[model samples]
Target: MNKAENIIVGISIGDLNGIGGEIVLKTFEDERILDFCTPVIFASIKSMSFLKTHFKSTINFHSINSINQVASGKVNVFNCWKEPVNIDFGKEDTKIGEFAIKSLASVTKALKNGDVDVLVTAPINKHNIQSEEFNFPGHTDYLAQELEGESLMFMVTDTLRVGLLTDHVPVKDISKHITSELIEKKINTVYNSLLKDFKIGRPKIAVLGINPHTGDSGVIGTEDDDVLRPTLKKIKDTGKLVYGPYAADSFFGSNNYKNFDAIIASYHDQGLIPFKTLSFGQGVNYTAGLNKVRTSPDHGTAYEIAGKGEADENSFKEALYTAIQIFKNRCDYEEITSNQLKKAPRIERKQRPN
Candidate 1:
């Protein structure tokens, strides 16, 4: 395969002790995956080898010191750590957590340096991965801080796309954060993402309400009516096809979301609950509005099923494909728009014919 044609996918080995390594091994086990993009795993070669041996995986990968050594049609791994730490599968070890951060930081550097076209992150344990160097709730915030922009935690699939107003925040604090300004910001992010990343020219967006039954005409809660409604109106006034304060409970049941290009939830569970319910094993968690492309499986570190060879790789694989597709879509959009600008309008010459 020509290096020029391959999309280099940078993968961060999420928790070394979790199913991150197992799923990565399974995803690349089939060589056909290399047909679309080249995969670069940012982790210790030692740890990967240990997992491969334990899992009895037939997957073959090349270890490299830098992404510049990546080869098309091959699974290339950039060694983030040299030390051979004990492979404690399904256990929460602090050392493993530290290396996970190292791997993420390493691949993130490559993403910033333009060495990789996109990133597909494995799941990480939020608690264990916490440290002085990595102090975020999850991948969304960490990437948002590193990439610098409005980061909307977007869960997507072939069937549905859902975005969150607040990610990894506590339930009690959710309402305080659901202000008009915040709603406007996140809704705008979702709209732009649909247009650029998903390539929807005029995305029809549905914004979910914060309270049950959309505040029941202000009896249940007033945020939906006072905050979300006014904010959505402002968004629609700007010529965007945005609507909402829709009741989250009935939105999915009524199949109303089918009419919209994307749905925005006022909180984490509000949007993701329905999305994960419908597309749990196939959903891709895409971080939209970032400076670069980043995606991950909707599931987390399944410690109970980590080393059992029972962890499904469908979601992880979808994440990889989604990142590549979004990158391609953005490129195609830029070309289409740029070419349209280059094409001048036709000039009329009627009198000259006589």
Candidate 2:
């Protein structure tokens, strides 16, 4: 790993009563993980120590008050709060929610100040985290508001990538939310993320239909034909590589997603169900279209097996690697593009002949 590319990954311990701490500790259990990036976990050292004891982990960490004090090849825990935290493994309480927000806020501040290069957030409980401070639907929305950019809920694994056009909206409200303008906006975000973040020169994007059978020529619905079709045509006309308002039902079954670099699903369930089904324990949820790099495990707070030491860490590990890769990719893209933008030698006029 190039020293220049070695990043400081900022982690937010989400819902202390859940498996967030467990999965995070498990991911870093192998010291080899420290080879790629320096990790700075934004949580209380006391909480982490408690969890470590419970999990019987031999992993050790350094506690620091500031990001500048982080050491290379060591897991650093940023002391966000000094108060002792009581961990009730399988219980949900307002105190846990308050601590979760504190952790997230601390880490996000580090991220925005360039103290940390990328952020790999552990799973957060949406309902519990909902307070006057954090009233957003989920992490994607909160990040978008904090970073001042539109966020695409992009799910990623080795084989496929899925983006949601409408996120965290009710089923009845989904159709109203799926306007042509919204579709175009989210699709543009996905396209730009592929280019800048993922370093894809020309990404082929597949847009899924809102209704089954792609509206069946207006038999089932006209949203696919009227809204989706025209929007795709407009985007394609601009020389962007995009295709399809493909029927959602058969698109994944036919394995047609392989042909495209990314798929834009109409709604939350329409996209996430298939993605989770395909990549349950190994996928990363990437918040694309932000200037900063952020990703998280696809799974949520698994309270059922929180303290049992049975929570799988594969997804969390993948999230970390994915965040690192995206950070490197963005840096490489900017360097290459900046060099390419250098003006070529301008033709000089020969006045000697005149």
Candidate 3:
């Protein structure tokens, strides 16, 4: 783990109408959260003030006009918007959507400039946020556009990690996007991320079939045999530890996922269904293959329960801790790899039967 020198984590408050602010306040109530890193929230004081009164949580809010005012162990608030927000809890408003996007843009800029170590985003309403400025399906696509990296969304729990090949896409269009090149890229991203970010050497990976019973020898669908099998073989030929085209139904049923480091699903639901079923309210949604670390609670905005003080902060807490752990692991792996490269020639000579 990287030594704690006040890791600054930039947090974007999601749709204020939802429970984003409530959960954020609840999660930080524990002073232990400040021990590992400083959390800077990109939100307006008005939104946070609403949460304080609604949730009745006594959290110190230090408003900052700029990132330069951030301090460790302090809940530094960067006021992204100057206007007052009248949030109707559990209601959908386009103004909240615009507010959410503003917060996102602010934190993303900080992340790109290295002012923040990791980004922990709260849930945003997709339909509400569909404006001229925010046209992406969700945060994953937005981050992909901003950072220009292969943004792969994965759900993380203490027990399992599942990545999606096609996220936030229609079920009918899933097969059209599942090309061999895309599959290989996603696998390579997962493989390299596990090695570099998770400190896993030669991580085992599992790929799920697009059809039932892995196409049942071409009886059900040709996608598994034609697209997935060939891609899996190619990945295997590269001396990487990968196994797949497993029947999606039985894969999660027989506990086969326990053997692999990560599983790549054909689409969003294929991966998210099993993952959420197993780790609901506790899973952390992580965006891998980015230049920086980004994680969010696996669940949605939960508009039904917003501002009722009913939102669980477990997933948010997990997301924060997971981001910190991945950051530390990545830093350590880089150091170890650098040292190994420096001594590789000498070690190779000693092992050559001198």
Q: Per-residue lDDT of 130-246 in model 3, one digit per residue for the tens? A: 987779999999999888568899888878999988898898888899999999999998998889877778799999999888889999979988998988998899999999888
Ten residues in a row with the worst lDDT in model 1? 1-10
Q: How do the predictions measure up, each by TM-score?
A: 0.94, 0.95, 0.95
Q: Give the TM-score of candidate 1.
A: 0.94
Ranking by lDDT: 3, 2, 1
**Cα-based lDDT for every prediction:** 0.88, 0.89, 0.90
Better of 1 and 3 by lDDT: 3
Candidate 3, which ten residues in sequence have the lowest lDDT sum?
A: 345-354
**The candidate that achieves the highest lDDT relative to the unseen native structure:** 3
As a TM-score, model 3 comes out at: 0.95
Candidate 1 lDDT tens digits, 1-354: 112357999999999778998899999999998998899999877888888899999978798996778888888989988988776778988888888889899999999888998999999988888988788898888888889689989999987999998988899999998888888888888888888888887889888888999999889988877888888888799999888778788899999999999998888888888998998999999999987899999999999887888989999999999998889888887788778988969789678664
lDDT of 1 at 272: 86
Root-mean-square deviation of every model: 4.2, 2.7, 3.6
